[model samples]
Target: MLPFAIGALRAIVEMLGLCLLGMGAMALLAGAGRQGNPVYRLFELITRAPRQLVARLLPGRERPLLAGVLCFLLLFLLWLALAAWRAALA
Candidate 1:
């Protein structure tokens, strides 16, 4: 059980790190004005799908910074939820 908890914590940390790295990459691309590039479009399709969906449901034009931050928060929340579920199951 202890090992399992440690593994879960490690996975959560790694996920959060990846999310931060991805957010940084997105910001760099946005800053470089490459948002229209095919690679960026593919990235948006793969990574930012949920943000895009939510933006469509909301009013006003999409803001990359805001969307990225929200996505990071959502990912963090997902990690927390997973950790909690694991703990409960244990």
Candidate 2:
């Protein structure tokens, strides 16, 4: 049971990391030009939810990429802590 819970937590952390990476990348691309690029379109579509949520949270923030970078750094540190805790439990 403990192992299963740890595995689930790891999976969730990995997914969150991926989501943050994608959001940060997309936000960075939003500046160079948003049209005529399918990759940008796809990323924009995929990251819509979290980006919008972040935008709402920080209304005065003028740059989405900066926001994404901060979020990624925060989540990365959190993931490291979770990984360490899981290793200790194991």
Candidate 3:
């Protein structure tokens, strides 16, 4: 059960990281008009939670791209920690 929970968490973190990557790509492709693109909006919506969390840690400014990158790194660290825990359980 513990291993299963860790795996689930790892999956979630991995997914969020992917979403952030996709969001960044979309932003690049869509330019300043990304807000009007559905795909971009979807990625943005999915990554919003992590960005908001990072925003609180950052303090000042509306730097979404920077927040997204920081969020991705944080999620990657979390995923690595969960993997290590799961390996120990195994």
Candidate 4:
């Protein structure tokens, strides 16, 4: 059960990181029109929570892209840590 929970958490972290990366790519591909793109919106929706958390952490900062990048790095680190933990358990 513990390993199962760790695996689930790791999966969620990986998904969010991918969403952040996809959002960055979509933003680049669509330019200023990314807001209207359904795929971009979907990625944004999935990553909204982390962006919001980053926003709250850095009040008055208007750089959401930077926040998204930070979130991606943090999630990546977390995923790595979870993998290590699962390996130790095994």
Give me the candidate number with maximum lDDT: 4
Candidate that beats the other on lDDT, 2 or 3, i.e. the better one: 3
lDDT of 4 by residue, 1-90 (tens): 999999999999999999999998988888999999998999899989988898778756898877888888889999999999999999
| Steric overlap count per candidate | 0, 0, 0, 0
- The TM-score obtained by model 3 is 0.92
lDDT of 2: 0.66
- Please provide, for model 3 over 19-58, each residue's C-alpha lDDT reduced to its tens digit, 9 standing for 90 to 100: 8888888878888998898988888888887789898898
Taking the tens digit of each residue's C-alpha lDDT, what string does model 2 give over 13-49?
5665686676456556675565556765665665566
Alpha-carbon TM-score of each model against the true structure: 0.55, 0.57, 0.92, 0.94
Per-model CA lDDT versus the true structure? 0.63, 0.66, 0.86, 0.90
Question: Which regions in candidate 4 have their CA more than 4 angstroms from the true location?
Answer: none
Residue 16's lDDT within candidate 1 is: 53
List where candidate 3 sits over 4 angstroms from the true fold.
Answer: none
Backbone clashes in model 3, listed as residue pairs: none
| Ranking of candidates on lDDT, top first | 4, 3, 2, 1
